[model samples]
Structures are given as structure tokens and as C-alpha cells.
Target: MKKDIDIPEVKNVHVAVVQEKHLEYKTIDWNAYIINNSDTDLETVLIVSQGKSETKITPPMRHTIAKLPARSYAKIEFLQEKVLELNNTFKVTFFEGNKMFDKTYVFRKNTINEKALQTLPLMQLRGVLVK
Candidate 1:
């Protein structure tokens, strides 16, 4: 007799905020990304703020990921007139194998590097989802 075995699904998706500096312009840029570590692709990806207050507090930001391939990443750029506090929260939702998953990531204000403002062409903030 032959038996069938069940395999577990891979759910190793992560979200991060990357800060890059431009020496020529003497400016710093911040970008958010959704990183997929699973073997399967994540479809119908949607990322947004968790609450109304969070949305109102932060400057205008855009989420630009329609689909995230396996072992790949998608970037989200923020369009702001002024640099606000780094503390923020986001909700990430995606589908994998007919199953949907959602997670929340928080970027603390403490992670912000005040010194990075004086420096140029440097990576300032890097955040990863905990657990």
C-alpha cells in the first residue's frame, strides 16, 4: 500500500524600510520593501496603514507592489514635502496557494539616525519584521 504525505507551506515574507543617501544631491531617501523568502509567489499583495490615525499622521506614502515573485522584493516609495518622524506602522497582506496572510510591521522612532542627516551617501535606517 502507498501512503501520501502532507507538506507544509512556506510563509517567510518580510517587510523592511531602506534608507539611502545621495552624495551629489546631499539628500537621503527612504524606501519600503516587501521581501519574499518563500519558494511560492505571493499574489494580490496589498500594503497600507493599519489605522486612520497612522495614515493621517504620516506624510503621503505610496505602496507600489502588484505582485511579488518568490525570493524577490518590491519597493514602496514615500512622497513627502518634509521629513517626518520615522515611527510608523504598516499592514501587509498577500496570497499564497489560495491562502491569504496578513502581518503588521512597526518602525520605531528610536531607529532613526539623527547623524545621518549630516552624512551623505549612506544607508541610515533598515528595519525587518520581528518574528
Candidate 2:
């Protein structure tokens, strides 16, 4: 039987876009936030990309949940290329372990604006701010 899924509320804190050679890797910071956007716990992670070339830097790993406390913060870094494959569009997936949450984001090497941000929410979010 299919079981119900419990997804936590996660808010993206910051994102760093790096351009190396002809490849671009985006590092995103994610943390648990209150439903009312009040306070957050201090729990974070540093997720780096496996790399851009066909040779993956690291195998796909599971992301642990950030039990963000109010007034605290959690940092999560993610490689955009992993979720959004080359030439592909935005994508969303369920992240499990420590906490259950959904990862909604996009991978693109273009301008950052309303048009780009608009595509973010479609993945189930208000909008993802790209830098």
C-alpha cells in the first residue's frame, strides 16, 4: 500500500553561482523554516557538486533533514547540475533522512530575472532566487 508522505517546510537561504571553464555549478543553501516564517534552528549542510564532466565527482548521496530551530539557521549546499541535467529543465524530488522534505529547483546558465524565477514556483515554491 502507498503510504502518506510528510514534508517539512524548507526555505532556501542563499545560493552561489560559479562559472568554471564552460561548466557552471550552483551551490544552494537550504534550511528548515517555520510555516509562518518566524524562527529557524541552527542546522545546515555543505553539499557540493559531483562535478560537471561525465565523470561524477561523487555518487548520489542522501540529504539529511535540517531540524531548523526558530531564530537559528541550517545551511545546505546542492549542485544544480545534479538535479537539472544538462540541456534539461527544472526538476523536483523528495529528500529523505533526518527529515523528509522536497527539493524544488532549476538548473540553467542564463539570466536571473522574473522569467527565470517564474519557472521556479512551478516546481512548488514561491520562487527560487538565482544569483
Best by TM-score: 1
Candidate 1: C-alpha lDDT = 0.58
List, residue by residue over 7-105, the lDDT tens digit for candidate 1: 334357766655667678777765556678778788988778422234456544446466788878766654232333545667777778777777777
C-alpha positional error of residue 107 in candidate 2 after TM-score superposition, expressed in Å:
3.8
The worst-scoring run of ten residues by lDDT in candidate 1 lies at 115-124
Best by lDDT: 1
Count of clashing residue pairs in every prediction: 0, 12
How does each model score on lDDT? 0.58, 0.34
TM-score per prediction, in order, is 0.63, 0.31
TM-score of 2: 0.31
Judge candidate 2 at residue 127 and give its lDDT: 33
Our model 1 lands, by Cα RMSD against the true structure, at: 7.8
lDDT of 2 by residue, 1-131 (tens): 23676566655433323222223435342221112123333344323222232543344333443444443323234334443333212222323246544343334433322344432311234333431
**Model 1: pairs clashing at backbone N, Cα or C within 3 Å:** none
How does model 1 score by TM-score? 0.63
